[model samples]
Target: MTRTELQTLPERAVELLGGEPDDTTLRRYLHGLAGVDAVGLGQRAADLGTRSIKTTSKAWALDRIIELIDLTTLEGADTPGKVRSLVAKALNPDASDPTCPRVAAVCVYGDMVPHAVAALGAAHGDPDDGGVSVAAVATAFPSGRASLAIKLADTAEAVAAGADEIDMVIDRGAFLAGRYGQVFDQIAQVKQACRRADGSYASLKVILETGELTTYDNVKRASWLAILAGGDFIKTSTGKVQPAATLPVTLLMLEVVRDWHAATGEKIGVKPAGGIRTSKDAIKYLVTVAETVGEEWLQPHLFRFGASSLLNDVLLQRQKLRTGHYTGADYVTID
Candidate 1:
């Protein structure tokens, strides 16, 4: 969709809120949101995490987890060689084992999109084989503190360089300061910038940095705000924060997506990024998704894990499942 198509968003927001919402009106809507029961939410997540999956189910889950991974590398020291190596790992996660599935996408910084695109084409012979997508983090990335022009330029450059997906960060400062209109307008503008020259737009993943939001209520408000503002996926964090992507936080976002779909019939994706390192940890997230949202969300398009080391752990577990024994770290290539 184009910016012209979304010009009526303010009207839509007014309708959604039952009237035109000024800043005070927006705050009232946000404050009127139901309070989260932290204790109950944590208990539910913990209980769901304990539901055991046997060998067969676990094997199935391992493959699904592989497909759901973004296979990310967003470090300051990122080089083209590092991106090429990561792209190779993304294309063939387990080289010795062809049965293992490729990851959903290769995530990198905006500047690295061209490198990743070239590497993917060289490795796979066709960059658009649907084997993997190149995701670029834009809009000032982990910190959305830059001007809108720079942010839009960041997104447009990544798109022009052939990033299939754009992971843009929300201005937490604006949101926290109660500038809801500013936050919503920035997201809408970035969504517009995601539109490629070919008329097909890249999928936009809005990172809320939930850890910085400071409350489950803010998380809920941010989820709704992003979805309503045209985010294809509402992400947990940028992974730079200390407490990125916790289970309780992810569970709250899942509930937001579920309820949003029920109300609007629009199915927005969810990504739980950062600090998720083990296959066991990934499986608990899967369980929460299955029980909270439903089986329909098990696909890669609807769910994703935004982690670098998590891929290796998942591959190792898949190898163990295939060979009936644990494999050493040397077996699976590091990301």
Candidate 2:
């Protein structure tokens, strides 16, 4: 509960993961392995790993960020082509994706979930289709800004309609007014509502709308509170605000994820939404993960980006590499 207690792994660290090896065993194995450090790894990640003199190489930070993109930025039924484009970009963030890691997920407003799901489903049928998931923004996003009854119904609809995951924004007005219990209770209830009688439910990501919270301390508190209240992922914004997601805010949240994972042995995810538009920006996020939460959180289930525009640039860079011609223009414009 205290800082020192949180910094240390839980008493049942090994037991936290049922039937898994203890932390001591993990430490000993890494200590004995070559080029491995049980303790020094996270402490040593470099910024961009030294900027390339060639100016042609993608920043190591960007490469990592590309790997974690959720690529949602999608809306409307007519925008499936845009989704397809984003997928292409993600698949080829560099050189036609000769060896690029996949994007974390593809996010969309809830109404578009059926379309997004159908697109991915079609892709799955093709042997060459690259797989990415659909994350739906639910519970009256950009405004948590609504009644709890309406919010719950909204979340239930999204999950039932084929949303692999749901990103719900919290009511910042309540949080800022020091109504912590109200904020926390709403999140917990919404998370429960997302579940079905079949015991299946979309992953619930609670968006704190960090910009609205307006303070680093508040961000940290919100992150902790969200994790405590059963948020599978704590996101930064709705991408509708002027100062949606930012590096500093993300850094604070990432630290919270690290601390939460250490204390409760629960790996709550982090998502930075809004204003991220380039592969370079994306990479910085990867650096944050490697440095703050270690390499394991880099997976799609644990990390995500909510940008629609960033995907095109990532794809353009890839196309340039493959055809030896870098003339492709921007593929998406913000709506």
lDDT of each: 0.84, 0.65
Model 1, residue pairs in steric clash? none
Per-prediction TM-score? 0.90, 0.72
Q: What shift in Å separates residue 44 of candidate 1 from its native position after superposition?
A: 0.9
lDDT of 2 by residue, 1-335 (tens): 22122222223433433322333443342233233231343333333222221222343334445666777664445376766665555444555356665666667777766766666654422111346666778778777778999999988887877776888888888777766667766887788777766775567889988877776667776776676566788899988876898776777778778877786667878888889887656655666666678767766678887777776666656556456774423211111
Per-residue lDDT, model 2, residue 129, is 32
Residue pairs of candidate 2 with colliding backbone atoms: 61-283, 62-283, 70-105, 72-107
Instruction: Name the TM-score of candidate 2.
Output: 0.72
Backbone clash pairs in model 2 (N, Cα, C under 3 Å; residues 3+ apart or in different chains), count = 4
Best by lDDT: 1
| CA-only RMSD, every prediction | 4.5, 10.6
